[model samples]
Target chain A: MDFLTVIQLLDSTVRLATPLLLACLAGLFSERAGIFDIGLEGKMLAAAFFSAAVAALTGSVWIGLLAGIGASVALSLLHGLASITFRGNQLISGVAINFLAAGLTVLIAQDWFSQGGRTPSLMGGARFEPITLPFADALADVPVVGPVYAELISGHSVLVYLAFLTVPVTWWVLFRTRFGLRLRAVGENPAAVDTAGVSVIGLRYAAVVICGVLCGIAGAYLSTALQAGFVKDMSAGRGFIALAALIFAKWRPWHALYATLLFGLFGALETRQDVITAVIGIKVQGQVLGALPYVMTVIILAGFVGKAIPPRAGGEPYVKER
Target chain B: MDVVPKWAEVILVPLISLMLAAILSALVILAIGEDPVAAVNLMITGALGSTYGWGYTLYYATNFLFTGLAVSVAFHAGLFNIGGEGQAMLGGLGVALACLLVPWPHWTIALLAATVAAGLFGAAWAAIPAFLQARRGSHIVITTIMFNFIAAAVLNYVLVNLMRPAGSMDPATARFPEAVHLPTLHDILGVVGIEFSKSAPANVTFLIAILACVLVWLLLWRTWLGYEIRSYGKSESAAKYAGISPFAITMIAMLISGGLAGMMAINNVMGEAERLVLNAVEGAGFIGIAVALMGRNHPFGVFLAAILFGFLYQGGAELALWTSIPRELIVVIQALIILFTGALDNMVRMPLERLFLMIRRGNA
Candidate 1:
């Protein structure tokens, strides 16, 4: 492949990876604190709908972001109420949340827009405009490094840069903070954290809320930046893919970035069927490429490729001894 | 002794949960600027008002009966088999191959052969995940979910590249032979001097679903294997100490689950469509989850819950046809039912338990 084609593919990879990375980090926070959240896809879908709807209505992307976060956090609190407070099954709660979001988004969209369950195509300030980095234009005429910098990294929406930056921020907060230590401890062994005089429920809820916020941003990025508006089931199976990426990363933040980017590359390659056919000397089915991430995750999960051990307390509700 | 009475546990809990779901669904209708009462009225009349309506409702119920039982069987062994969608899809492929490859002399014989093919395909699809969970300690929930996507891809490839008829624009199999066409409800009822909707898709597969429900009840409550499965679900350590093999129970439970899910294709594919088509399962597999949850994973309860969902589905279609209400409202209701009955059961159960205790104290 030509250098420009490679650079273009990488650009799309960055764009596609942003949502998966954000959702992976979201799942990271919840799962790290001992709460398993399969509702990440649902939360992202809800956020995508509300963000697009609000942006189309009020013509303000900031307000739309807030609405998106509010919707996701509301669902997260519901998860907390069911799984944590009521001591219900976490996986069942996550399943319910996903169905709730999937149905509600289309229902509300249909009610409001009457255009077959989709928001209108966003315009002007309602959408996230791509931001060209400083010196991108000036360095365009330079050799290989210039195109790599300008074409591949320079022009992406503000959310893409923020998503990448959050990786380092997450690593710092997780490894370098007292709250992080307690959160990780709670996930591994809540009884120890409880013995240390920290409230396990409070820490877990905090983690869930943080998860909601990141997922909300991921949804917003999909609707406002990556695409022009909301579409039915727009989050698709990205949430599950994010979960797979989290497992592939072994629940670490840095590994999450690389894992999501690799999944994202698979997604990018899916769009360029000609490139794949040329390299392999045979036409590959698009569905095979589409199913790659899920198949890989299943392989990893079976421990054929690598073992992915979740947190010890993950998916279990905590109960204090009387 | 149980804290609550059996009658209340079976009847009152689901009743109260359904009411809560209905109230929330009503509010959602109000938010959409539609009349909740009117919508409910329309649903009732549309789904139950005529023979035609009952035909569609029963047809949908047949699909749910198979899938709901699929979920319930796995639930008994503490396994959540969410791969029903994938299993059902593969089952359609099985049905197609069975009907297309052979020229049967009779419909009954073709039905028997298709059922075996569909069940085998579904059980084979589920076995890998069950094996992983049983031997490798993989989470069945995640593995099954992954299998759903893979199954969808497999179906797409088979239909497009392998199964599609020559020169056909659609990614669907050619029509099945006349001998393989299962008798619909209209024909069956006609033999009994009863009139039914001629165009409706309700068929002999519905009877098969009812029979399967009975068989499942017999398997779960009457058999020693059922006892072992239930014991394993209640407590793995206790069951292990009691000499029940966890691996055997898990595999058996998932195989039954996958087989039942696959049988749904006999209704939608063989009885109704009479040919294999892409996206035939739609979201019925997920709807099965809601039905099983509402049914309390009991065969009888699954029967009742499946009918209720069938009513909602047919009625929702009517609403979409006549009114501005979207067909997806049924999905919204289904989600609420899952939320209230499965995830948030304690929200109603705790208060009911308190009430029951108060009544007992008064009696004392």
Candidate 2:
């Protein structure tokens, strides 16, 4: 392969990996705080659904993105109320919330929009326009890597930049900050954190909200940036993939980046199945390709790489006995 | 006002949680641009509108009933076996293959073979996670969910590409023979000149579901193996302390759960479809979570909870038809049931204990 093709392929892979990268970080934060946020799917779906709806309504992409984040944050609050405040089982509540989101989206979409859930496509606000880096055009004049630098490396959404920035930001926050210490402590021993008089509830709540915001962006990216207009069940188990990434990364932010990128590659393959098939002359159907990532996740999780030992108290809610 | 005693706590908490959930559902309806009261009324009327309505509800109900039992069996063994989707899918596929392959005149053999196929396939599907957990100490939830995806994909590919009947263009499998079909109990009811609607496929699947419930109860409470399984489910360490092999018990528990889930295919393919045809397995396996929870892992309770879900499903469909309300109210309702069942379990248990304590005090 030419150097140009390699750079171009690599560039496209980055744009594709952004959403998974963001969502995986969200999972990393929540799980590290010992909250197994299974409702990531619900949060993502709700955000995607709301963002698409609001964007289509107002014809403003920013408003839609904000709405998506708000919806996901609200879902996080619900998770906090049930699992944290009330000491409910995180997994069950998360799963329940996901089902509610799935059902509610379909119900509301049918009742309001009536297009079998493909909301009216927005011309402007419905999507994020790809951005070209300032120096990339000039850099593209370089031999071999020139076209690759301009097209693959440069043309991407703002979130693509944010996704890369988030890795170091997350690492610094989790390791450097006092709040990060508290969060990590809580994951290890909430009772001890409670003993130290740092409010476990407050820290966990903040972690959950942050997780929600990440999921919201992930959702918005899936709909507006990746493919415009909300598709029914559009998260398409990406949240679960994020969860798998978190496990694979051992709840570390930087490790999660690589894990998510791997998953993103799987997803890109799944989406580009026709291309893969055409190039290889393989006669695999669309559905088989679609199921590939899930298959990989299972094989990986089933002790192929290693056992997924979650945060010590992950999924166990803390209730103060006064 | 009287002080709420312990024994009544269990029942009261669930009652209150259910009411709260209902109110929340109403809010949800309002939020979705529908009249909650009218929508709910429609749900009731639609589910039980006529004998025909009752049939469809029962047919759907039987799916939950078997799925519920599948979940409940694992609950008894103290493992969250979430592979019901795959297990049930394989079950349906197994039944379809048997019905297609077994060319026989006898209705009994055809039905038996098909059901047996479902049970065995379900067992295999469940065994994947069970073996992983029992032998490798792998997490059941992840393995099962993965298995579900694989099962769904494989089943769809087979249905669309390989096993699908030649003449049908649709993504479905070969049609089952008429003889293997589950006979409707409504037909039997009509023998006494009792009238019911013709559209209803209210078949012997309901009875089969009920019988499975009874068998589960017997298997759990009556048999020593059931006792051992329950003990194992409660705690691996405790069960081991009591000399039970958690490995063997987990496998057995998972097999029964998967097997019963497979039996639920009777409702979907043979009982309802009149032949073994393919449609993607709906989220009934996941619904098994809510069913198992509402039933609180009890056989009779699971059976009753399934019927309740059936009621909600039928009513939700009806509401969708009558009003502008979407039919997913039932899905929300089921989700709420799961939420409430989990959240309010302690409250319910506490009230029951208090009630029992007060009753004891009064008796003394």
Candidate 3:
């Protein structure tokens, strides 16, 4: 492929991968802290709808973003209440949250907007506008680096940069920070953390909340930036795909970025099937191409690619006495 | 002697949880500026009052019965097989193929052949995940979920490329021959001199679903294979000690689950739609998870749960048709029921256990 074509593919990969990256990071934090969250999809859906609804109403993307985060966090707290407080099955709680979000978003949206279960199309300040970096225009004429700098790196919604930046920040938090240490320890052995004078429930709840925040950003980015507004089931299977990506990355932040990017590339190819068909000179079914990420995930999980061992204490709700 | 009665454990807990969910759902309806009482009345009338409503409810319930049984069987083997959606999709393909490839003389012959094909197809889809989980140490939930999506893509490809009728704009297979079209409830009931809704989609597959439930009950409780599966589920190490292989149990359980899930296609593809259409599985596969949970992984419980969900679906459709309540609200209600009955069980159980303890202490 030519340089510009490659850059364009990379650009599309970035756009598609942003949501998966954010959700993957969200799952990373939650799962690394020993919580198995299958509800990332549901949380994102809730955030997307709330964000879009608020953005349409107030015509301010910021307020909508906040509302989205708040809505997602509320669901996270609900998960915490059931899984942590009530000692319920984490997976079941996650499934319930997903179902709740899926249904509630459309129900409330239709009740409020009456636009057939969708919010009004967002525009102007209500939607996220791409930011061009300072050197983007000036560097546009430069041969090899210009388009890569201007087209691939500079022009993206602000949330895209934030998502990419979160990988490093997550790495720092997970390794360098005391809270991260405690979080990891709690996941590996809650009893050790408890004996060392840290609260297991508190740390887990914190992890889940952080997860909710990241998922919120991802969801808001979808409705406000990726698309003009929220539609029912707009998150599609992205949350589940993010979960697959998380497993593919073996629940690490950096690996999550690569996995999501690879998956996003698959998705990008799916959207641009005609271009790919012309380039490859073959008949390629879009559905089969779309199925690549999921198929790859299965192959990876089956230990063909590499072993994926979850956190030692993941999925089990911690009991204080036990 | 156990403090908790078997009957109470089976029935009481779910009843209380369902009641709590209903109350909460009513509050949500009230919040939406609608009359919760009227909504409840409408739901009952719409789902149960008329033969027409009953027909749709039973039809939906038939689909749930298959998928719910699928989930329950896997659960009994300590596996969370979430790929029922995908399995059912493949089963639809099997049904389509069976009806299309051979010119059966009658619907009975077609149903028989289609059942085997659908079961084999669903089992084949699930077998991959089961194999991964059993031999390769993969998580069944994740693999099965991914398979669901893959199943959709495969079904789409087949429908578009292979099954679509010539010159047709729709991405669906040509309708099955008239001889292969299964008898609807109206046709069967009328033969027995009982009037039924002519347009209702409930058909002979509903009987098959009930029979499957009965067979599942016997298999789980009476058969040696079922015993082995349950023992393995209870403790893998213990089962190993008892000479039960985890691999065998997992495969058997998932195959049965997938087969049950696949059988749902007989109702949808052959009975209702009469064609293999894209996304015909819809969210029935996911709903199976909720049904399994609500049913407590019991065959009888699954039957009741399926009917309840079928009611919600048919009733919800009526609500959307007649009132301002959106169709998605039904999903919210279903989710709430799952939340309360499945996730928040301990919320109710802990308090109930304590109360029971207090009563027993007083008696002592």
Which candidate achieves the best TM-score against the true structure? 1
Per residue, candidate 1 scores C-alpha lDDT tens digits across A1-322 of 7778889889889999999999999999999999999999999999999999999999998888889989999999999999888888888889899999998999999999999999999998899999999999999989998998898989999889999999999998888999999999999999999999999999999999999999999999999999999999999899999998998888999999999999998899889888877777899888998899889888888898878999999998999995
- Please give, as one word, the docking class of candidate 3: high
Stretches of candidate 3 off by over 4 Å are none
Q: Model 2 off-target regions past 4 Å?
A: A1-12, A274-288, A319-322, B1-10, B274-278, B344-364
Candidate 2's docking class is: medium
**Candidate 1 CAPRI category:** high
Residue-wise C-alpha lDDT for candidate 1, range B1-364, written one tens digit per residue? 7778999999999999999999999999999999999998999999999889999999999999999999999999999988899999989999999999999999999999999989988888889999999999999999998999999999989999999999998999999999998898999999999999998899999999999999999999999999999999999999999999999999999999999999899999999999999999988888889999999999999999999999999999999999888888888899899989998999889999899999999999
Q: Tell me the spans in candidate 1 whose CA falls farther than 4 Å from its real position.
A: none
Candidate 3: tens digits of C-alpha lDDT, residues A1-322: 5778789999999999999999999999999999899999999999999999999999999999999999999999999899888988888888889989998888898789888889999999999999999999999999989999999999999999999999999999999999999999988999899999899999999999999999999999999999999999999999999999999999888999999999999888887777787788997899988888899989988889778889999988888884
Give the TM-score of chain A, superposed on the true chain A, for all candidates in the order listed: 0.98, 0.91, 0.98
TM-score of each: 0.99, 0.92, 0.98
Model 2, position B142, has a per-residue lDDT of: 67
Interface CA RMSD of each prediction in angstroms: 0.8, 2.1, 0.9
User: Quick one: ranking by TM-score, best first?
Assistant: 1, 3, 2
**Candidates 2 and 3 compared by DockQ, better number:** 3
Instruction: Please give the range of 10 consecutive residues that has the lowest summed lDDT in model 1 chain B.
Output: B323-332
Number of clashing pairs, model 1?
0
Clashing residue pairs for model 3:
none
